[model samples]
Target: MNKVKENSVFFVSLLLTLIFIFWGVFFTENLTKVTNAVYNGSIDYLGWVYLGTTLFFVFFSIYLLFSRYGNIRLGRRNDKPDFSTASWLAMLFGAGMGVGIVYWSVAEPVTHFTTPPYGEGYTVEAANTAMKFTFFHWGLHPWAIYTVIGLALAFFQYNKRLPAAISSAFHPILGDKIHGPIGKTIDILSIFATVFGIATSLGLGAMQVTAGMHDIFDMPNTLFVQLLVILVATILFLISINTGLERGIKFLSNAAIICSVAIMLLVLMVGPALTVIKVFFNTTGLYLSDFLQMSLRFTPFGEGEQWIASWTLFYWAWWIAWAPFVGMFIARVSRGRTIKEFVIGVLIVPTLGTCLWMSVFGGTALDLVQGDHSLAKLITQDESLSIFIFFDHLPLSTLLSILGFAVVAIYYITVADTATFVLGMLSEGGTLNPSNKIKMTWGVIQSALAAVLLLAGGLDVLQTASIAAALPFAIIMLVMSYSLLTGLKNETVMQKGNKRNTQQN
Candidate 1:
């Protein structure tokens, strides 16, 4: 018999997810209304909680880099990183953000430019604010959330020889209870969060791919086309997962990084290069200067409250929902690095890269929108197709559009493959090498969830479902942070005691 039957975490999570997906499919209208209400209620009531927790994660990540535990390696003292620095960064960047960067890079800035948080639409100020907040949304806070989870899991799994699972991070606090109901609940929440998180991404990627196909080949942008995109992408990912991480995920990631950068460079070279460079640095500076103001900006008495709730709060919840999958993937590739190295690499590198990408893609798009308001209309019509429209105005429009489509497709595969591996691990008692059979099962579930959500109500439904699923996982992340601190403190005390005993002997 398959060990899945013996794994409560896997079996229970699968049962619950199936029930939820069935509800979503059969009662699309009711599920959509309920999920939207829950999403809004959580934002209205727990918006502050989201802001406060995200800020704490950011601060805590920085502290880990300089703390006494900084030198503690994730694995044994003599172990080195399993992958090259370039490969490691490629995987991190590709798995962590990937398709969203390409999809949102232009679309987000244009949206904010037209309806900024606190500025006139389509003006220079709105353009500047759009890029700044874009940087803020895609910046360090999200990575910090991932870092906390990744560090905790890696520390326990490698340093302390615990199972490679989110629940294991709580062992320091809950002790043996981590293996009981408490631990199972935490792992279950992680699984739900990972599935919805990846499903949302898959849905978004499908729309973008459909839009690109429409833009390039004049295909109809209908639900049927979008479902087809998801089906084909899922099949490709399932095949990719069978190759395992080393040959499949790693190769796809490296290829994605290269192709994505090429598209960015083409935009920079063909568009206003100097303007993109200037906007990037300026927006980055603004982001750092207004980091606090942006992080905690909840407008109770102002008109911008809805905007903050929709954009900022949504991004925070999405990142938290994604932390488990991304964090676990980071941990898997980051076995031999120290806490300091891992923290700095995760928190700093991907963040700066995101800023540059936003600057180039977003900057160029914003400039075009300002000059010709018609460009902004394309975005309002369909956000997914906006990038392709933006490409139409630049040099090598046809080639860049094709490249953009390829990047989205490859990113979808990378995310699905990585999620399959991580979800399999979570369900199968944290086995480092989960069965391919289990992985294929989760792969189908993920694709099914995305397809159902797409049929239910498209992007809004997808976003609402992700935010709703993320609520419990947010609490889990907070507890994980506390447990990590406790674990590190205990390790420090043990080190000192051993040092004193050796000296006395």
Candidate 2:
């Protein structure tokens, strides 16, 4: 009877993943209608949700780093850094911020070039707002969400002898006696959410790559091209996941991020470096000044509602949606890490990457527009055209621009690859060592989802789907908060006893 039930659980998990894959590809158009409504409905408090999450994380991170809780070590039998700290941070950030940062480094700045929300009146160096907005999006708050879950997963998995699954965090509520079918159900939901959430990012990345390619090469955007890219992404991730994080995924992440850094340096030298720096700081200043007001504004009228729903709210929901997949990666890598090290690394280093990237892509677009009367307005005419206008002003023009487009293409693949690997882990009952077959299956699932979303209208569908997945997780996050708080309270006593034993001995 128990064996039969175990097999049944596996079948149900498999069924959910297959269903999501189908939804992502074939039914994504209809799926988008449902998802967009959820997106629209979330708008009323989505801004506050993001702001509150950000603030809680900032404060929580401070507590973790400075308090005794920071010293808490996790993992089996003994506590030490479970993974190399640098490798750990890289994987976590690469999985979490990889695609969004890549797409926005250019798209965001271009959006800001014409009518930056805060300082629409900043006449001279409007691109400054572009850089600042990048910081805001990739800053401390977003990382906080990942950090909270990472801490919870690591603590419970290690100290409590639980699997590193989201439901495992609820052990205090359900207890070990409630394992089996109940536990499997939670695991299934996590897997389903992780797969769809990641596919959403992969799909969006593919579309951005498509648009960027169209601008650079004048190639027609077609389903055939998108599918080819998706397949490549799946294969890359399958190889990486099979090889596991220590070998393949680590090398690939390091290489991809390094290549991106080199591209940014190239843009800095050729584009207006001084102007980019200045505007980046300028945007930062403006964002800080208006942070609270921007955080809470409902903006229920005109494009205000539309912008908030599509732009800011979309970012909020997307981050929330991605919370599970990315959050899980962070948790896995964070074993043996002091809370202080994990929190700071997760929050601060990634923000630097985000700021610089925005400076490169956004600043370049702004400079092209500001320097040339014709290109300035062209930047905003269509998001797809901004890259073309900016490249028009580059040193090698067409050649460098094509390479730039290729950079984005590869970046998307990297994003998809990481998403595929992570989703595999989720489906494998959050096992520390998941099977390669599971990884490959999830990879294929995400690829199919991306294809469906792209064919249905690109990122709009992806965004809608991702946000809807997150709404349920919002409730999950809340439940997690109480469970984590209870766990941390118990951990405090355990630490005191350990200290006492050492002193008495």
Tens-digit per-residue lDDT, 265-334, candidate 1: 9999999999999998899889989999998997777688889988999899889878999999888889
Q: List the residue pairs that clash in candidate 2.
A: 80-336, 128-279
Question: What lDDT score is found at residue 74 in candidate 2?
Answer: 66
TM-score of each: 0.96, 0.88
**How do the residues 292-339 of candidate 2 rate in per-residue lDDT, one tens digit apiece?**
666665655545565555666667667777777777777777777766
Pairs that collide in candidate 1 are none
Q: Per-model C-alpha lDDT, please?
A: 0.89, 0.67
Query: Can you tell me which runs of candidate 2 are displaced by over 4 Å?
Result: 1-4, 7-10, 20-30, 45-47, 76-79, 118-130, 177-182, 210-219, 300-303, 373-377, 381-389, 397-406, 456-459
Q: Which ten residues in a row have the lowest lDDT in candidate 2?
A: 118-127
